[model samples]
Target: MREWHADYLDACNRHDLDAIRSFLSPSVRRAHLPSGSDAWIDDLAELFTAFPDWRWRRVQLIAEEDRLAVHLRAGGTHAAAFRGIAPTRRHVNVAEFAMYRVMDRRIAEYSGTGDHIELLAQLHGGLPT
Candidate 1:
């Protein structure tokens, strides 16, 4: 199970949408709680398009039976608008935590949290020194 999770993270780092989807069941139910969003598949496909160079680095991963929780950092240059924010062309890295519900060895649901304020601040002119 940990190996599967590692592979999924690797796929995310690679920004391979198809490879990432391979870890999801056909009927996967995705829940992006932070934004109150849901989907059957392609949950994060749009994010890739927004941050073309986005990447994730896992800080830690914990698994308890069918559920897995991960602490990680995700970042990329703001090359395009996201959630209505115009492109900033600045690099931003933010810490994020996510929980995944696995079913039949696939991710059936996912909920994550991140510091949007920090991200937004960075997009404007980066963090204050």
Candidate 2:
């Protein structure tokens, strides 16, 4: 399972959606906590469209039973509009944490939280003075 997480992280960094999808089960469910968005795959595809170079580097991975948690840093250049925010074309890095439930050696569900406030502040030119 550790190796699976490692490979998953690598796939994400490489933007290899094929590989990423291979590890996901048909019933997979994923959520972005900050935005309260739930999506299976289309949202992810849109994200990659917005940040073509977006990548996640795993800081740590922990697993207990069928649940796995990953700590990572996510960053990329803001090249397109996202979440109703126009592109600022700025590079942003934010900390993120995700938990996944594995069923039958595939990811069945995932929920993740990221530093969206910091990300938005960076996008909007460092918040209000």
Candidate 3:
């Protein structure tokens, strides 16, 4: 289970498109979207590109049945544009949570939330988005 969690974060931090693609199940769904995007793999890849140095830390995992809920804090220096904001070089930390449904011990769908508001606040100096 830890190995699975580590691989996901490693792919995220490295922004490795191949790793992301190879790891995803064809039916991957992201429940965070109102219309549950089926393009989770691509969306994840884009997010990492937008925040190239983005990294996850202090991860916690809970397992039940064929699913896992992951909690982690992500932080990085804002060296690139994100959420329509230009570079701020601001160090920001945000909480992240994801629930993954596994099929045959392979990830099938993921629902996630990230605190982008705090990152925007840090960049905009008191502005919250």
C-alpha lDDT score of every prediction, in listed order: 0.73, 0.76, 0.69
lDDT of 2 at 82: 79
For TM-score, candidate 1 versus 3, the one ahead is 1
Model 1 over residues 1-129: C-alpha lDDT tens digits? 789988988888887767876787666544444222234223365566667898888899999999999998888887877777888777788888878889887777766674256777777676841
Clashes of each: 0, 0, 0
Angstrom error at residue 108, model 2? 1.1
Which pairs, if any, clash in model 1?
none
- Model 2 lDDT, residue 117, Cα: 73
- Give, for candidate 3, the lowest lDDT window spanning 10 residues: 33-42
Badly placed stretches (over 4 Å) of model 3 are: 34-38, 127-129
Task: Supply candidate 3's per-residue lDDT for 36.
Answer: 30
* Model 1 stretches astray by more than 4 angstroms: 32-43, 114-118, 124-129
Worst 10-residue lDDT window, candidate 2: 32-41
* Candidate 3 C-alpha error for residue 52, in Å: 2.2
Cα RMSD for predicted model 3: 3.1
- Candidate 3 local Cα displacement, residue 103, angstroms: 1.4
